[model samples]
Target: MKTPLLQFTDNGIYCKKANVYLDPWKPVDHAIISHGHADHSRYGHKKYITHHRNVPIIQHRLGEINVTGKEWGETFDVNNVKFSLHPAGHILGSSQIRVEYKGEGKTSILFGYSLGKAQRLLKYLNTDIGEIYTHGAIENMTEVLRPLVDFPKTTLITRETKKEQLLGNIVLAPPSAHGSTWIRKMVPYVTASASGWMTFRGARRRRAIDKGFVLSDHCDWGGLLESIEATGADKIICTHGYTDIFSKYLREQGYDARTEATQYGEEETEAALASKSTASV
Candidate 1:
């Protein structure tokens, strides 16, 4: 039972023995994507699986291929491995993957991007399962807060405050084809929510400033700890945030969790180039 070896540059998890690639967007044979974000979706793949709704976007970009789409909770079989797409609550067609190896008799759930607050745009996907119900009562204002629960599942943004305040609910969903619009909107929200622990949600796997969602697409600092407690995954590998803070929080929770921070010296260069190119366009 080994945690998958994830490559930092590509954010691709490759099983050398199985020869399977998870979320490989750079022209791989099989690219199992968590969402339709450009960084997660790519062309020149022999076959792949993604959210059912994202099929339109993927096909529109990648043309023809062996494309398999899955709805939430539906397990699909590929190469003798059974995996199900769970709602990550990042965008319209966002999903977290739950992989079950029938042969190995193992069940593991990976949150491609999970959120605790249910947004208005995607309230239909709210589910009462897990700690969401437990934490729903933390603040009376958050009673209506439902995130990634159930269809059109996406991320939710709450205005944090040191002194209790009623700032109304703010939701952050993917505005355009890519996550640029969402990230743009996230800047303001992050500034607003900086008082408390801010979770930079959608841009987890990508190594760029504008490549993903800027909303709290996953459980926030508190949410992360709580969800980790509920799911009880043997080993927790947290990527995509301030390493020291996440590690400290995880350690205090009495879990065998650790941070995996990947360094990408050239990543910033690529981001700058992309930003410049987009500006020119």
Candidate 2:
């Protein structure tokens, strides 16, 4: 079955396949959100679907929108297209999206952000530009030009050299086995990865950061490729990344892949876009 050609936009559609909105940032009549992140979940909606635990968060954000909570593995149909939510791992209630078209019976493309370490599992580094000189580096002009950075290489090395230095063991929680996994034993899945804003507070907790596993909120190059391979997908639509490099890499691997440059945010829809052009003229 031909997977409905997915058009990358704030709101998504598959004419023959049930429409699936990855994460509705704009005001939509009906919506399904992957998580409660401010960028993903926004105001205005008649009904919204999300994780059961996120109902409160949704309510707080969207006010009176009818919030529907979905458990992992449950399927719902929207205009004949079947979509199911799976754990995304970016946050407590994040999900990776899977959609199927009833007409084709072929599994539609799987939209995954690829999982990352939990919010609490990592501490980010924070260095202020102003502090570089204020902390006595002002004495030497040459020293001011030099950059200073702190990475947790020592802690990682220590953990590898001495097991006692390891505060906690790293455990890889395999993706859901039966439904999402192809083999049911071990198949890789992309978790929603995000880059966090570093703060001075996080810099103070460098020890904690060192002890935790470092991962991204969006899929890295390797993880993106792995997700594509795991799905056994014939064609891939890459977005939200350095698409040129990723698409080139995918093509090198003999996969029919293309990169999609989506908009900055929902603020730029077709109608809104047309209006901007008119206003500019």
* C-alpha lDDT values of all predictions: 0.47, 0.46
Task: State TM-scores per candidate.
Answer: 0.36, 0.35
Where model 1 places Cα greater than 4 Å from the true spot, the runs are 1-11, 16-18, 102-281
- Candidate 2 per-residue lDDT over residues 1-281, each given as its tens digit: 85544556645432234444556655666677888888888777667888887788878776887888988878788876767787777987887766655322211111111122211222232111001101011112112233443222111121123322211222111112113222122122222212321222453144222222333355555677788889999998877545787788889989898987776631112233222221110
Positional deviation of residue 56's Cα in model 1 after best superposition, in angstroms: 0.4
Our model 1 lands, by Cα RMSD against the true structure, at: 21.9
Clashes of each: 11, 10
For 95-184, candidate 1 gives per-residue lDDT tens digits of: 887664533221111111112332322343233221111111112212334342333332222323211121212232221212453234
- On a 0 to 1 TM-score scale, where does candidate 1 land against the true structure? 0.36
Error of 1 at 62 (Å): 2.2
Model 2 regions lying over 4 Å from their true place: 1-5, 10-16, 103-281
RMSD of each: 21.9, 23.6
